[model samples]
Each structure stands twice: as C-alpha cells, then as structure tokens.
Target chain A: MLIATALASVFIRDLFAVIMVFGIYSLLSAGFFLNLNAPDVALTEAAIGAGIAPILMLGTLALTRKKWDPEPHAKKSTHTPLLPLIVVAITGAALVYATFDMPYYGDAEAPSHTHVAPRYIQESGQEIDIPNMVTSVLASYRGFDTLGEVFVIFTAGIGVLALLGFLSDGSGRKYWQFADTASLRRHTVLHVIAKILIPLILLYAFYVQFHGDYSPGGGFQAGVIFATAFILYTMISGLQAVYKIIKPELIYWTMAFGVMLYGVTGLVAMFMGGDYLDYNALDHHDPIHGQHMGILLVELGVGICVAAVMMSVFFNFAGRGIRLPEDTKEGGQ
Target chain B: MSVVLGLFNYWIVIALMMTGFYLVIATSNLIKKIIGLNIFQTSVFILYISIAKVKGGAAPILEEGTELYANPLPHVLILTAIVVGIATTALGLALIVRIKEAYGSIEEDDIREKGGTT
Candidate 1:
C-alpha cells in the first residue's frame, strides 16, 4: 500500500494529488515503523510526514498558484527517460547486491545486534535510569547529534526568514489584507471545534514534553504537536489572529533561545568541571539525577526550538499576503 | 524461493528507492523532484527500521521483566533524521517558491529557457 502511494505520487503529474498521496505514503511508513517496533521514530514520522509537510507544500502551492497553468497540457515532461532509468537501475542493483552479505532481517546474531545497541539496551537502565532508551540515547547519550539536529532546524528557520520574511513579508508594509476578524467569525463550526481541540492538543504536547523519559515521545514529537496546535489555530482564525495572540518577535526569539538553551546546558556542564554535554557531571553527587536534569533541559530546549521553527515556517509560507503578477521582478512593486 | 523470500524486504526497499530516483531525474517539474526526494528519504528509513527488528523483541521502551527488545540505536538516529528531513524539505520548498517568483515558472527547462539555471 505504501509503495503504491509512492508510485502514484511519482506518476501523478498534478502537484496537488502528489502532495496528498505523499501524505498517505508517510502515514503508511509510520505504520511500517510501528510494525518493526520503532515507536519513537513512528511518532515523529507520522507528525512530520502527514501533518507538517503537506501544510507547507499546500502553502507554497497557494503562493505559486498564479504561476502554473491548471491545464493538463502544461504538465508535459521535457527530460528524456533513458539516462535516468539506466542510472536508477544501476544504483538499485548495487544496493541490492550490497545487502546479500548482510544478516537476514531481525537475526539476533547479526553484527548490529552484537554491537553497541545491546549495551545501550542493557546498561542504560543502570546508567541513565530511564525507561525509554531512545530518549536517553537521544537527549543524554548522543547529545551532540541531537544538538546538531536542533541547529539544522534553526538554520532552516533562518533561511526561510531571509527568503520569505515571516512577519511583514521581509518588508515594512502590511503583507496580508484580510487578517480581519470576519475570517474566523464566518466559520463558527471551525471556530468552536478548534477552540475545544487546540487546548487539549497543547495540554497533550506538555505531557509528551515532560514524560519523554518514560515513553515513546521526546522534544521532537512534543514540539511538533505543540507547533501543530498553533498551525491549527492559524488555519482556523487566520495568520493575523495568531500574531495578535502570540507576538511574532516572541516566536522568532524563541527559536534562537531553544538552541541557546541546549548550548547553555552543555556549557554549564563544562563549567561544572566535566566534558561538554556530559550530563553525568550536571549533578555530580547524584549522577542519575544529573542525567535527569540534562535530559530534561536539553529536551525542553529541543521542544521549544522545534515548536517555534514549525510555527514560523508555517507563518512565513502562509503570511506572504496575496502574490500578484506585478510582484514578480527584482523587488516587490 | 526461500532465499528470495528471506531477503524480500531489502529487495522491495531497493525497488521503492528507484521509483524515487526515477521521478527525480526523469521529470522536469520542481515540485515532483521534491516529492521524489521525499520518497527516496523514506526508503532509507524503512531500511534502518526493518534491519532493527527482532523477531520476539518488544518496543524499545523498557518494561519490567521484558527480556527481549528491538535495537534502539537506529530508532534514535532515524528520529532525528525524520525531523531534519522535514526541515530540509521546507527549505527546498521555500527555494522552489523563490524560483517561481523569479523565473515565473517551476519547470526546469522553462526556468533554463528564461536564462535562470535550475
């Protein structure tokens, strides 16, 4: 089923249908992850693959709608298929050939099974005292990689801001025209449902935020759901309504702050006479408790940064006022 | 037959990956390329996960008296990878929008015809 969706996306010339099919492709992959016993990954994949990717794509479509002709005749491919087909076939064959010597799926005696994974599985309980090994590995053990991941997200946010200019469309003028309250007031059903659901989603985000050590969620999932709640709010009430409630400056600073918080946590550990990002030295007297402190702060940092980035990206994509044909040249006319 | 059956998951994953590869290079549309990149990304993910599975193991969340558990390492890496993928895709889509604004078209040849290299 997942492969079918992907193939459909590849064959479907219409961008809108491709994006929708891509969403289902992601959702099915999430199900596949669950079947393989990677719930931590499954949670993040579902949130991202189905929820945020489509929203951003749709927003891009809305802005670029004026550029593309809707007529089917405009969808013809200009590239020849022969070279690309040969390349793809060769790559696929090489990949499959490489897998021949690999241990069959799920074999207990496989190289990976005998390596560091078992150590993380067996000793983490004693060392980190955390029930969720993925969280401990992510937020505590391999802290540097997660830090890099956070910065990647932060960098993307900055890139988008430079390109699209979030709050005023990178210029000083009012970007959106219809931020008027009538947009939300016109749809009472949407308003009522969102009013009831947004708070609950926010509350659940907090649960995932704080309970990551014991469960399948951590900052990434929590931050995604948190930002998603705001995205939902924006969708229902319009981007202007969200800006009214949550200052755009606050969101921008929060993105920077989340990354900083992660850095500060590592620096504080360094100041305490331990290596950078060594959470064991966070509370030297009680190392487990120190691990707890480190993981919580880092996860909080991740959550805060991710939530801010997601919301800002959505706003930048959705906030571009209406794109007009005259707005095309070197500068906005 | 059993040899093929035993390794079917890996083979199927390869086929899925090439589907993405074909879309990316065979098509001229910018959005389709992004979607192809996404499909290619998922194949790698499914690769990591299927390799991590243990026949009798439970999910990586530690529970009392649960002896066997799937590998937690790949799960950790893929978790971050998934988010980074979205971040990069967002960046790609943003660039595509900018291209549309500047070139007035998203087709690669069309952009190139207008003297803007895709």
Candidate 2:
C-alpha cells in the first residue's frame, strides 16, 4: 500500500492528488514504524507525515494553483532521460549489494544492537535516571547531536524568514494583495471544531513536553504538536485573526530565545565546572537532581525553539497567501 | 536460500528506495520531485528500523521483567531525522511557492526556459 501510494503520488500530474497520496504514504509509514516497535518514531511520523506535511503542501498548492496541462507546452525544453535513469539504476544496485553484508532483520547479534545500545538500556536507570531510554539517550548521552538538530531547524526558519519576510513587512504587501481569504472563511464547520479542539491540542502539547522523561514523547514531538495547533487555528480563523493575537515579531524573538536558552544552559554547566551540556553542574548538591533539571531545561529549550520555528514557518506561508481588506483600503493604487 | 528468505524485508526496502530514486530523477514537476525525495527518505528510515529490531524484543521502556528490547539508538536518531526532514520539506515547499511566483510555472522545463536554470 505504501509503495502504491508513493508511485501514485509520483506519477500523478494533478498537484492535489499528489499531495493527498503523499499524506496517505506518510500515514502508512507511521503504521510501519508502529509495527517495528518504535512508538516514539511512529508518533512523530504520524504527526509530521499525516498532520503537518499535508498542511504545508496544501498551502503551496493554494499559492501556485497551476493546473496540470496534459498537453505539453510548445517551448518545453528537451530533457534527456537516459543519464538520470542510468544514475538511479547504478545507485540502487550498489545500495542493494551493500545490504547483503548487513545483519538480517531482527538479529540480536547485529553491531548496532551489541554496541552502546545495551549499555543505554542497562545503565540509563542509574546514569540518566529516566524511564524512557530514548529520552535519556537523546537528551543526555547524545545531547550534542540534539543541540545541532535544534540549530538546523533554526537555520531553516531563518532561511524561510529571509525568503518570505514577516507578515507585516511593507514590501510584501503587493504579494499579499493576491491572497484569497474569503475561501478560508467559508468552512464554518472547521472554524467551530477548531475553536473547540485547539485548546485541548495545546494542553496535550505541554503534556508531551514534560511527560517525555517517562513516555515516548519529548520536546521535538511536543513542539510539532504545538505548532500544528496554531497552524490549524490559522487555517480556520484566517491569518489576520492570528496576527492580532500573536505578532510575527514575537515569534522571531521566541525562535531566537529557544536556541539561546539551550546554549545558555550549556554555558551555565561550564561555569559550574562541568563540561558543556553537562546537567550535573546545574545542581552540585544532588547530581541526579541536576541531571533532571538540565534535561527539563534543555527539552524546554528544544520545545520552545521548535514550536516557534514551526509557527513562524506556517505564518510566513499563510501570510503569503492572504490579503487583509485594510491593505487594499490603504495600498490599492 | 534460507539466508535470502531471512533478509527479504531488507530487499523490499531496497526496491522501494530505488522506485523513489527513479521518480525523483524522472519527474519534471518540482513538487513531484519532493514527493519522490520523501519516498526515498522514508525507505532509508525503514532500513534503519528493520535493523533495530531484535527478534523477541520489546519497545525500549524501562520496566521489570522485560529482558530484550529493540535498540533505542535508531529510534532516537530517526526521531531527530524526521523533524529535520519536515523542516527540509517546509523549506523546499516555500522555495516552490516563490519559484511559482517568479517563474509563473513550477514545471522544470518552464523554469529552465524562463530563467536558464531550474
């Protein structure tokens, strides 16, 4: 079913069908992760694949709205397919050949299973003092990698901001003129349902944020969920209503603040004479308590940055698609 | 033959990966290319996950009487990767929105002809 949807999405020329099929493919992959016993990953995949990815794609479709013309354009530049085909075939063959040496699916003796993993499972209770080994590994053992991931998200947000600009930027007003807001307002069912559902989603996001130490979720998933709630609100209420509530400038500040919080936590540890990202330095009297505090603060930093970045991205995209009536009243020449 | 049977899941993922790779290269539409990229990425994810499984293992949560558990490392790594993937996809789509605005069409040939590069 996954392969079928993926193939359908690729071959389909109609952008709407392609996006829908992609959403199905994402949901199916989430199911696949569940089967693999990776609930945390499965949850992220479902949220990202089913929830956020489609919303973003639909937003793009709205902006573009280029009909799929079956008839090829007269000036369609000639593209050679032979080279790309050969490249793909060779790459595929090499990847398959390499897999022959890899341990068979579910083999306990696999190198990945034998190394570091066993220790994490066995020692995490004492070292990280967390029930969820994945959280312990993510927030503590490989904390540095997660730090890099947060910055990568931040960089992407910065890139989008530079391209799309803020919602209130005067220079973007011309593009905003073409934005179609009346269509978004037509769905009252969605509006009413969203009004009921958005608060619950925000509450759940906070649960996932703090409960991550004992469960399958953490700051990353929590942030995405929080951002999704806002994206939903923006979809139904129109970006204008959201703008009145939360300024675009506040989102930018929050985005920077999240990353800075993560960095400063590490610096505080160093000043306390522990290595960077060492949570133990946060509370010298009780090292375990310090680890707890550090993880909480770090995850809080991650959640804040991720939620802000995702919100800003959605706002930037949504802002690109809608024109305020006031803009016409003021700028229509 | 038995070894081949044991590893059949890996082979299927490889096939899926190739299909995605083909679509990415063969498709002319920019959005379709992103879809293809997503398929290719998810296939790699399946590969990581399939290898993470231990035949009799349980999910990696600390509890009494659970001896064998799936490797938590891949789960953690892939969780981060999934977030990064969505971020990348968001950026790509944003670029597509801008491309359509500037080039007036997201078709590769149209963009290539208009701007001499896609």
Candidate 3:
C-alpha cells in the first residue's frame, strides 16, 4: 500500500493529487516511525513532514499548471531509455550488495553499539541530567551540527523571502487588504478552530523546549509547533492578518535576533575562557550546570529562528499573487 | 513473532525509501518531485524509529517494576525531523504556488522553457 502511494505520488499527472499523495506519504512515514518506537520523531514527521510540507506544496501547485509538456525533441526521439536502464541496473546491484554487508537489523553487537554512542547513552543521564539521549547528543556532544542546521533553515527562509521580493516596497501592498466580511463569515469555522489551536500549539512548543531534559521533545519540535500555529493563522485568516501580527520588518529583525542570540550565547562562553560554543565555560561554576544553561539558551535561539524563518517563507510565498491562465479561470466549474 | 515483525518492517521501510528517492529524481512535475522527496524522508524516519525499539520493551516513561523500555532518543530525533520536514514542505509548496503564478504551470519542463526563452 505504501509503495503504491509513493508511486502514484511520483507518476500522478495532476499537481494537486501529487501533493496530496505526498501528504499521505508523510503521514504513512510518521505511522511507520510510531511503529518503530520513536513517538517523538513520529510526531515531528507527522506535523512538519506530512502536514505542513504538503500544504505548502499544494499552494504552489494551485499557482502553477496541472500538466507538463514533454521536451520537444525528447518526445520525438527514442534514445533516452537505454542509458537510464543500465544505470538503474548497476545501482540496484550495488545496493543489493551493500545490503548483504550491512549489520543485521538491530544487532546489539553492531559496531555502532560498541563506540561513542553507547558511551554517550550510558553517561548522558548523569552528565546532562537528561534521560533522552537524542536531546543530549543534539544539544551537547554534536551541538555544533544543530547550530549548522539552524543556520541552514535560516538561510533557506531568507532565500525564499528574497525570491518573492519581500524586500520590495510594493510587495506587501496587495496582501494587506482586510478580510472581507463575506470571506470572514465563510471561513468562520476554520478561523475559530485556528484561534483555539494556535495558542495550544504555542504552549506545547514551550513545553517541548523546556522538557527536553526528561522527555522526547526539544528545540526543533518547539520551533516547528510555533511555526505551525502561525501557518494556520495565515491559512485561515489570510496573509494580511499574519502581516499585521508580524510585519515584514519585524520578521527580518526577529530572524536576525534569533541567530544573534545563538552567536552571542556562544561568544559569552568563549569570553568566559572556553573554546567557541564551549557552554561549560559560561560561568566559573560546575561545568554540567553551565552546559545545561548553554543548551537551554541555544535551543531557544534555534526555536525562535526556525519559527520566524518558517513564518517568513510562508508569508512570502502566499503573498505572491497567483496568475492563472485566463482560460482556466473562465472555464472553472 | 517479534523478531519477524521487526525484520520485515525494516525491509519494507528501506524499500519504500529507495523507491521514493528514485521517483523524485525521475519525475518531471515539480509537485511529483516534492512528493518523492517526502517519501524519501519518511523512509529515514522509519529507519530511525526502528533503531529505538527494544525487545519486550514498553514506552520510555518511568514505570513501576519496569526496567526495559524502548529508547526515546530516536523518537526525539524523529520528532524534530518531522517538524523540519513540514517546514520544508510548506515552503516548497508556497514556492510552487508562486512559480505557477509567474510561469503559468507547475511542470518542470514548462517552467524551464519559459525561463530559458525569456
């Protein structure tokens, strides 16, 4: 069933259908994770991967065409398949061989179990006072990688905003018209639901942010939950409300602030006599306490930046007016 | 029963991931490609979650007289990944919408043609 859904997603002609299929794929993947014993990851996957990504994809599809024209010469020629076929064959063979050499599924004796991972797993609870090993790994031992990931998200948000010309003076004009009475009435149900859910989601985000030490929650989940609330607001109330709530200038500033917060936290540690991002040196106190404080502040930075960047991207994309072909609009049911 | 379920599930997850990736690379429609990307990502979630499972283990919460529990680490990791995936997808969709408005079609070929000719 999953294979069929994936195939249909790729092969489907209609863009909307494809997007929906992608959503299904995400949801299924989340289910797969839940079955795998990773409820936190499953929650993240379901929310971000399935829920938000598909919605964004669908919006993009609505703005674009339903069908693609084949390349002019390729349609007339028959020479493309042979090379692709051979490549697929060779790749398949390589994959099969690699599978054979891989450690048996869930083998406790695997090399991964014998190395730094087990040590970290064994010691993390005592060192960081966190039962969740993933949080400990992400925020401390490999905290730098998390930093890079946060920056990458920030960059992507900035890139999308630039692409939509959000910096231009005239870009915000069209989207600012207050929601019409009729449209508001029509969307009241959605609006009410969003109004109820957005606050809860934000509260949950904070819970995830602070509860990382004990449970399967952290900065990324919190950031995403925060972004989800705003996205919902934009969807139900239109881009104008989102703009009013978080003006473009504020969005840019907040994004920068988030990144700056992260950098400053690290710099403070450095100034206190530790290496760059050495959170343990933040104070002349116990190293673990310093580590805890540093991780908290840094995760807050990540959550803020991620949430801001995501909202900015959503606004930019939705703000770009759809320019459908005249015929499609006229011929609509 | 437990061992068989674990092995079979992993294999299926791996298969889905590969197939999804293959489609993403091969498809022409931008939306289809994104769908493929989602499929590809979900597979990784499966792999991570599977690693966290422990034989005869329950949920990772502290419980009376229960020492064995599934690892919560992977679950935590997957949760974050899920959120990121959603953000990426939402952004991707928004881009597609704008692209449609600007170029009149979501098909990769059509967009390329317009871009090239212009």
TM of each candidate vs. truth: 0.94, 0.92, 0.82
lDDT per residue (tens digit) for residues A186-236 in model 3:
677787887889889889889988986677667777777788888787777
Please report the interface RMSD of model 3 to 1 decimal.
Answer: 3.6
| lDDT, candidate 1, A70-106, per-residue tens | 6334545568888999999899889989888878887
Most accurate candidate by DockQ: 1
Q: After superposing candidate 2, which stretches have Cα over 4 Å from the reference?
A: A66-83, A166-182, A323-333
lDDT of 3 at B89: 62
Q: After the best TM-score superposition of candidate 2, give how far the Cα of residue A253 lies from its true spot, in angstroms.
A: 0.8
Q: After TM-score superposition, what is the CA distance of residue A81 in candidate 1 from its true location, in Å?
A: 2.6
Q: What DockQ results for candidate 3?
A: 0.38
User: Global lDDT for candidate 1?
Assistant: 0.87
Candidate ordering by TM-score (highest first): 1, 2, 3
lDDT of 2: 0.84
Q: List the residue pairs that clash in candidate 1.
A: none
What candidate 1 gets wrong by more than 4 Å, as runs, is A67-77, A166-185, A321-333, B116-118
Clash tally, candidates in order: 0, 0, 18
